[model samples]
Target: MSTGPVTIAVVAGEASSDLIGADLIRDLQRLNPGCQFVAVGGRHIKATGAELIQDNEVFSVMGLAEVLKDLPRLLKTKKQVVRTILSSKPDLFIGVDSPDLNFSIAKAMKKHGVPVIHYVSPSVWAWRPGRVHKMARFIDGLLTLFPFEVECYSGTGIDARFVGHPLAKQIPLQVDKQRSRAQLGLSDKKILALLPGSRNREIKELTPVFAETVRKLNTSDEWQVVSSNVSEAKQKQVAKLAAEQQLELNFVDDTSALLQAADFALLGSGTVALEALLSKTPMVVAYRISPITWWLVKTFRMMQLPYYSLPNVLAGDFLVPEVMQNDLTTDNLLTACREVINDPQAEQRMMQFHHIHQSLLTAQPDQAARAVLNLAESLC
Candidate 1:
């Protein structure tokens, strides 16, 4: 271990990235006890003792319109972050997820002679493939969660590594469904996990559709609906909708346990969908964005792949059904959920998803942590 103190800069703009950043910070501290961390992050990263240079909420806006509205504040925060990095002259910088903010900041850092390592390579393969060229120039190394992302980055000559997903390592290799249910105080009766999403924007866009779908399922007594707790405000919003629809919904903050207790899930298309896959839960994915954003995506044909769910992406087929944007409706979501939940062979097929999860775990022994450390070592 180096005797001298090393300052490392990190930035994780949202909840999922914050979790990954926290894990990386913990592993980095373990690897080099003298290392110091400073960055823009949330509660999890703060728990790891990273000095806050800026609050992550400044850059957490989603959707085109939302981002555009917050552009001025976002730009000011970016300048402050860049100024901090330049003044500190850290040994290395790690940007975990949040490609939009992280990529621009990494570009600035690289120009100032700092080695930048970007975790969670953006979905360039899915949309905006041209970003690979820009990323190759700005980022010293790129760490990816998905195996397929490596090929995309390698093709562009970016120093990229498939670090596997942190969740794959964090979640248990062998899941005991019955034990999980018992731990969550759930019964042997079938359970349906509802991950409306963690962000307020996501909940707003998805809750109505989700509640309607649950109402149509009308299997209130037969299947338990467990809605994830995003925040108190969002909880109230979702609760209001559930109450309005007279739907029985269990809103829980302990999402991990809730997911594990689930027989299957109806998840919004994002990190939660991937988490559900890790829990080996058969799921139907649904998502709806602002109408303008939806139209933009469709007009540009931004989605290169047919499926949105990560499990389906990994399988290279429509293994899980996705109803997105204009296509997402109560009837479609209900139908997909019913098919997946009621199928006699569903449990066995979901085991196949677990196989995919196992394959993703190829980056073992703390791959996310190791990748960040390797990048730090290369810089030294």
Candidate 2:
């Protein structure tokens, strides 16, 4: 009996990871045309011809309340996945982000003699540094976005690589603000980009404050609000919120363009912050996960990071103001945005953002694909 073409199993549970996973799949396909992918992914990875085992996005949940609400379904899905992966082992199993979900899948697949590679380094450097110990048990290799992340794997013998984020290459080093605004059909009005987040629960927690901030900022409609909505519901939610406050937002799906067109941004703290940095759009960040989630996190002291936003973590300093939780108020957000917009250092900060972008550029998809392939070859 002959083994057919190399078969890899991948699981990417979030939109960001889906994009990274798709890029990786394309590059892997280029190198090994006959390679087959059995995956738990979303639209992006599916676009690359990966066979779907499950829609990974369903497993993505934020806040303790939300997770608990969906816990029964999550457990059921987890068991179903365990059975799926173990039914027939593939050459390699790659888990992309959602380490909470991915690592569990990896552990199961690892026991079945599958070489396990995790695409994103869970913020062990930021929180629960102790996870470095557990990493050795399941993760064979870790593909990281930032070069500094390699330090997180210091004591662990786990293989890690800095593949560089694809966005650094995808987004232009310098965006033409005039062109972007022209394309978006905006006039002399200063643009304030709003990126609440993709998840409904996150929008629920943050959009109210975001609406208040926009209302305060748009006095006399001096600034045109441009918000990016990840889903139709979020777009409608933003619309409802804007209508309630009598605010006008040029809601668009093309977030990158909006980021490029904006004078500055007010966004929820997450991957959008990273995207803002790549777009060279100076922003003030905020987040509110739920009261119970906040209490539990504080009670347990779960997070170990000095900063919350990706730009701050990457720069090792407060690159932009992050007003999280209770501090995320209209007055505070307005102050931060005005400070950034009016400060003489605005250009200087954009320059710093440019430097950070340069630092993130590398042989992306190819290097990442090769790393995964090599790990699988060595293990299998």
lDDT tens digits, residue span 1-380, model 2: 01358788888887778888898999889887878888888888888988888886687688787799999999899889778866656778888888888888898888877888999888887778899888899988999989999888977989888888877777888888889889987787888887788777767767777878888877777788878865676688877776676766678777878988888888887778998999888898899888898899889898888688999998999989999888877888888888887888888898999999999888543788878777776777
What's the CA RMSD for each of the models? 2.1, 2.3
State the number of backbone clashes in model 2. 0
Top-scoring candidate (TM-score): 2
Q: lDDT of each model, Cα atoms only?
A: 0.80, 0.83
Candidate 2 local lDDT, residue 24: 90
Off by over 4 Å in 2: 1-4, 183-188, 363-365
Q: By TM-score, how accurate is candidate 2?
A: 0.93
Q: Least lDDT summed over 10 consecutive residues: which range in candidate 1? A: 362-371
TM-score of every model versus the real structure: 0.93, 0.93
C-alpha lDDT (0 to 100) for residue 65 of candidate 2: 76
